[model samples]
Target: MRKWGLTLLAVFLTIILTACNQNDSKDEDKKETSEKTSQKKEASQDESGEGFKALKEKELNSQRNKKTTNDSSDNQIIDYTDKQKIAMLLFQPGLDDKFITADDVLKGEYQSKFSDGVKKKHLPKLTVTSLPENTQMDNTPTGTKFYNIQPFPSQYSVNIAMNEHNMIIFGSQSPIPDYNELLHGLDGMAKVYKTKDVIKSEKDNPKLKEVEDKVDMQ
Candidate 1:
C-alpha cells in the first residue's frame, strides 16, 4: 500500500508540471503575436504619411479663422473679410511645401491652362459657374491671355494652375494676414475663375467686376 501511494504521488506531480509548461508556452505565443501586430500597425501609419496630413489640416483650420488684427504676435491671421473671398493655405503632397509659391508665378511667367486633373487634385470643391452669354469654353485655355497683377513679392517660388472650369488655383507659402498685412500677402484672396463676357457676366452679375478686379490684383 505504501509503494502504491508513492507511485500515485509521483504521477500527480508530473501531471501538474506538464500543465504548467503548456500554459507557459501559450502565454509566450500570445505575447509574440501581440508584438508583431503592434509593429505592423506602426509601419502602416508611417507609410500613409498621416503625420503630414494632420499638420496640414491644422494649418488650414488656422487660416480659415475670422480675420483679427489684435491677435498675439505668434500667429498672423490670414482671413481677409474685406476681400469677401476665401483665403486659406493649401498643402502639397509634402505638408512643408506650399502648393503655390510667390516667386515662381511671376507676371507673364505662366498662362491659364485647363487641366481636369488640376481640378480634381487641387480644388475638388470647385463648381461650374455659367459662362457669359457669349463666352464659350476655350478648349485650349493655355492660349488664353492671363494678366498677372502683383500683390507683393514673396520669399518662396509661387505655384499656380488653372482648372477646366476656368478657376485659377494659386499657391504661395507666405502667410498674408487678414487684418493689415493681407493686402501684402503673396496670393491674397485671388479668384479661382474668370469671366469672358463684360456685358453678359458683368451685365448680368453685378459682382463680376469685383471678382475680376480681385483676380487681376492677385
Candidate 2:
C-alpha cells in the first residue's frame, strides 16, 4: 500500500509539470504573433506615405506644362499700318531710364543712341511699341523677385509680334523691391526672349531702322 501511494504521488507531480511547460510555450507563441502583426502595419503606412508624395509631384508638373502651352498659344500676331507705326515712336521717350541710368536701358548706350540716327534720317515709317509690365518666370535657385521696363503706356500687358516668322517682343515693367531681384529678372527675360530670329534681327538691323524710319519726328 505504501509503494502504490508513492507511485501515485509521483505521477500527479509529473502531469502538473508538463501542463505548466505547455502553457509557457503557448504564451511565447502569442507574443511572437503580435510582434509580427505590428511590423506589417508600420511597413504598410510607410508605403502609403511615399505613394502620396509621388502623386503630388506628378500633379504639380502637369499643371506647369499646361500653363506653358497656354501662354505660347496666346501669343499671336497683330496688324499695324505704316502710319500707325509712325505714331508708335512716341512710346520711345518712355523707354528712357527715368528711374535708372542710361546704361540701365536695353543694350545700354547702343539702344539709347539709336534715336540719333532716327532724328537725322527723318525715319517716320517705324512704329515702336514698348513692352508691357508683367511678372516673369523665375529660374534662379535662390528665392528672388525680378522685373523689366515696358516701353509702352498701358495698364494691361501687351504682346508685340512683328512678322510671320513669329517675331514677337513682349515687355513688362514690374515693380521690384531690391537690386538682386532686378538683375535676376532681367537675366531670366533675356533667356526667355532670346531666339534665332531676334538675334538675326539685332545683327542685321541693329538700329531697328526699318521700324524706326517709319516714325514721324515732326
Candidate 3:
C-alpha cells in the first residue's frame, strides 16, 4: 500500500507541470500576435498621410501653371508710348488718300486694365458730336461731325473729325494712356479713297477750326 501511494503522487506532480508549460506557450503566442497587429496599424496611417501630402502639392502646382499661361498671353499684345506717332496715324489723308472711319477706330484692338480685381478690356465708346450751324461747312452742310471717346470715367478724352478744309484733325483733353497703339491698330483698317485736296484749316477755315478746338468731353 505504501508503494502504490508514492506512484500516485508522482503521476499527479507530472500532470501539474505539463499543464503549466501549455499555459506559458499560449501566453507567448498571444503577445506575438498583439505586436504584429500594432505594427500594421502604424504602417497604414503613414501611407495615408503620404498620399494626402502628394495630392495637396499637385493642386498648388496646377494653379501656378495656369497663372503663368495667362501672363504669357497678356504680354503678346502691343504697347504704345509715342504722341507724334499717334497723331500721324490720325492725320488726314490729303496727298496719300488713306481714309479711316469711326467704325474702324471703335473696332480696334486694345490692351486690358484691371478694375476691382477683374480684367477689363480697354475699349472706348464712340459718339458723333454735331457742331453749331455757323461752324457748318460745304462738305458737311448741316454741321461738322466729330467722333469722341471717353470710355473710362478716370481716363482722359479724345476726339477725331474732318474740318471745313476736309482735313482730318485729332484732339484730346489730356495725354491718352496707349493712344499710339490704339491709333496704330485703327490705321490697319484705313481704306484708300480719292478726295480733292483741301488743306485750308490753318488759312481760311477759322470757324470750323475753332469748333474742332472746342470738341471735348466732360
Q: Can you write out model 2's per-residue Cα lDDT over 1-218, one digit (the tens) per residue?
A: 99999999999999999999999999999999999999888778766888667888889999999998655533411243422322232233233322221222222222222323322122213223343333343332232212222332233232333322322223345533333343343443311222233333343334444334433322
Per-residue lDDT of candidate 3, residues 1-218 (tens digit): 99999999999999999999999999999999999998888777666888667877889999999998766533421121112112222333431222222223444423332244323353343233443343322233233334443332222243444322222334334433443323333343222211123221122333333333322333
1-218 per-residue lDDT for model 1 (tens digits): 99999999999999999999999999999999999999989878766788767878888877766334234211322222212221111111121232332112222122222332222122212121322221232232442222222322233323332322232433445432331222233244342432221122323344433343334233
Give the winner by lDDT: 2 or 3: 3
lDDT of the candidates, in the order given: 0.37, 0.40, 0.41
Clashes of each: 12, 18, 0
* Per-residue lDDT of 189 in model 1: 38
The local lDDT score (0 to 100) that residue 47 gets in candidate 2 is 64
As a TM-score, model 3 comes out at 0.24
> Per-residue lDDT for 156 in model 1?
34
lDDT of 1: 0.37
True-vs-predicted CA distance for residue 54, candidate 2, Å:
9.3
